[model samples]
Target chain A: MSDHVVSRRRLLRTGLGTIAASTVAGCKVLDGLSAPDHRLRHFMERANDLTMAMQRGVLDRDALAQEFAPVDIRQPQRPNGVTDPQDADYVAHRNARFANYRLEVGGLVHRPLSLSLADLRQMPTRRQITRHDCVEGWSCIAEWAGVPLWHVLDRAMVHTSARYVLFHCFDTIERSLSGAIRYYETIDLVDARHPQTLLAWGMNGAPLPVPNGAPLRVRVERQLGYKMAKYVRAIELVDDFSGIGRGRGGYWEDRGYEWYAGI
Target chain B: MSRNTPPGPLVRRHTRVTRVTHWIWALSLFFLLLTGLQIFNAHPVLYWGDQSGFGFDNTVLRIGAVDDRGVVELFGWRAGGMGVLGYSGGAVRAFPPWATIPSGTDLATGRVIHFFFAWVFVVTLLVWAVGALLSGHLVRDLVMDRHHWRGLARDVRDHVRGRFRHAARYGPLQRLSYGLVLFVLFPMMILTGLAMSPGVNAALPWLSEGLGGRQSARTLHFVLAAGLLGFFVVHMVMVVLAGPLNEMRAIVTGWYRADAQEAGDV
Candidate 1:
């Protein structure tokens, strides 16, 4: 019995030693792999890509964001991240009540039309009461009235080469060493042409407030609130966003947030 | 009393697969909780309905603090009640560093760690569930029979009297708790998690709506996690109470020696 107990203890010790050794070795290997950036984050990025693919492949491309009734509009849309713009151009436009404001729809487009807010409102419009989910774990529902982004794209005559629609906002979210950078966001043609996607100019039965990106804002309803870029200035259609603002795609995307904020 | 009778010979209790899966679950769940708490610290308030934010009065629970500035400032909202809601003090900080992953306030890192282990937790659960079902572990061992209910009541009574029976199979309480964890809590956790995702919501809009709303789903996720924590605490206490060495041996090495009297009955 004594011998048996001794042997069992030895076996357990050997097993524990092997496990400890393997753990140390694994740590070393992981440390080696994590040189450039965090290895875990690298894996997370791949996971994010897989999620995007799964979402696109499995779910209906035209699936609309869930809309609520008028009674369901709970909170007055809370302004998030750079509510007011201090830029000279934006100030001039705001001072004039955006009369001189022209939404330049150029880039990979044929017509390259510069439409005014009145022109956008005059075109075919859609109104929706949808929930806006923030990355910070909050939600708000409000009525939004706008022209379908597809209509604007159609009028601008988006070129066949245009694979993505980029929204360049007038609000300067931050001023960096490089220069004063404005907030920008991008979505593929699939989302841009989604029936619910809108270039919203009205909110809660009233003209869009300055605090709520008056005159224009893009509502990519199927995405998180951040993807709905406020303070709309221009719409540029491009094949790739590699050259745009730090290159990860959108302003927040450049700051380590997922480019496809679908969730 | 047959006190002279020899104790039962050691018998296998847990299978190798069961032991491995159990350890994996234990480890992954620990990480998930820590990481989840870290994520929760970013927005330490939970609400019901379609919307929640600054102007909304739909807060159901909140965790925050007040400072020496005499400002009864709150991080998310004033505590729903005293200690029931969350940690509150002179300087309010909901879920301090030790309680959260990465040991600091980092939502991005928290998310990454949480998601990575989330897949681990999911995959291991699937494998264990499938294995359990195929091996009849779910039916033969975990599931309680009608007779077991009578035994369960007796066992509870005995437990209250500080009497414990050494048995080869799990008692009724164990089976019921295990069943709840396997059939209800884990699945609810996974479903509520998926409901939070906009992509998943797009695929199945009814999921979030059925759960009340996105914010409600988040609230449910936190509540379910707390329920699991309760289970964990009870489970640990039970393990300790049942004789840690014996229970640990049974789970780790699959061998358990039943008391002589119980052994003879079996």
Candidate 2:
């Protein structure tokens, strides 16, 4: 027999042998990987990484989300998650109509900022009508007005070591048996520097409503609605999100959703 | 008793590439459907136009239920429409656990399964397209000719009447169904799927726009998936009607027993 035929037969034999072995031990293998404390499956991580890489490699860094005409804003944006936070501090701020509310921006920065709503509005601003796509299979278009996040990062003199921007929110999505936990989200520096990444405080020519994250919210336009942390309380620059909330980068992400929910 | 029956020789029907790709497509599609439904159950309501949520009058379909004390709530809609989807007494379940992967509301697991199989489905489709082109299977087997057009009505009628003749080549109705699936439905599914991705939206903004918007694209994706499911059901029925063992063997082993009457075509 020719060498090619011999090698082909050998390869097929080995392949079949491996398949048989795996099939025999399939239940055990699955059980081990599916243990409660197991890390995210390698295949899931690989898929997410591949998607992230493909998006970053193919698209321009500054590519914008599709902007809509004013007429396209047909319906009011729906409030998801905790619309009204009942926490003591949040309640105090709400009673004052957020007069005492100060957005603290610190961590890995030369100048930390404690900016109020009035302070934020005075800065250079952009208004664009864009669609907010939820992971739950719905969308809404509304005009958002806010200062670009990068401009704030620049004013704060973000250190070169800073790789991510994390948002701390006022709403508590759940108070589980473990403990009370607040909502938080994070984005990489690339998204942080995007022009559409805004600290939005206004919607559709009016101040944001309590149901829709009044006072402030982060708008990473190229991401799904979950990434846009609402009822913003603070912004912190970090080298990594390993120490943040179960180390999964965001609230929903820690609970099983993909961190990079670009879809 | 007759003693002069002739044995027919086995003929090559499906190519090795065709068989492998066909199975891959079948497996991936199965997983995709289960996982896609799991994802859909996260938000069972579908809408049209630009936006949809509470206070939006844009719901095209909803799957919900009524509770004790006649409090009807279809995932937030206070209405009563129960024949197709909603139920009474039991908890409101859009698609039951049996229909979903993980058999629970695990969007993360659903997404992972969906995405992994999506790559498998797309890659297999591309490979099949290339193989079909090179093997002339696209032209010789799938495409209908002028003669086929003339006999299309008769072929459809015969199909409906259960008067199918065992033939070496596919009939016009088969070609038409396969052609529509291969060309129109699959491509629409892929495009609509991509349009829902914000990453893909950045890469190709026009894709989402052409489909009306991300939400509209999502609606289209569900609609097309349902179309594919319909095709699958019909395909399965046809397979059983046409002879399950023979059809299965032809797809699996790439060999089929030629009909004695259709020997002339071969």
By DockQ, the best candidate is 1
Clashing pairs in 1: B65-B92
Give the docking tier of candidate 1: acceptable
- lDDT for position A208 in model 1: 94
Q: Model 1: runs farther than 4 Å from truth?
A: A1-36, B1-7, B53-56, B68-92, B257-266
Interface RMSD, model 2, angstroms: 3.2
* TM of each candidate vs. truth: 0.87, 0.87
lDDT of 2 by residue, A96-166 (tens): 99999999999999999999889898999999998888887778889999999998899899999999999
lDDT of 1 by residue, B1-266 (tens): 21223566676788887899998998788778877987887778788866785675677777654432221224343333243224434334467555666555566666666777788888899999899989889898888889888888888886676566677877788889998998899999999998888767776899998999899899999999999999999888877676665677788898977776666443
Candidate 2 TM-score, true structure as reference: 0.87
TM-score of chain A of 2: 0.86
lDDT of 1 at A113: 87
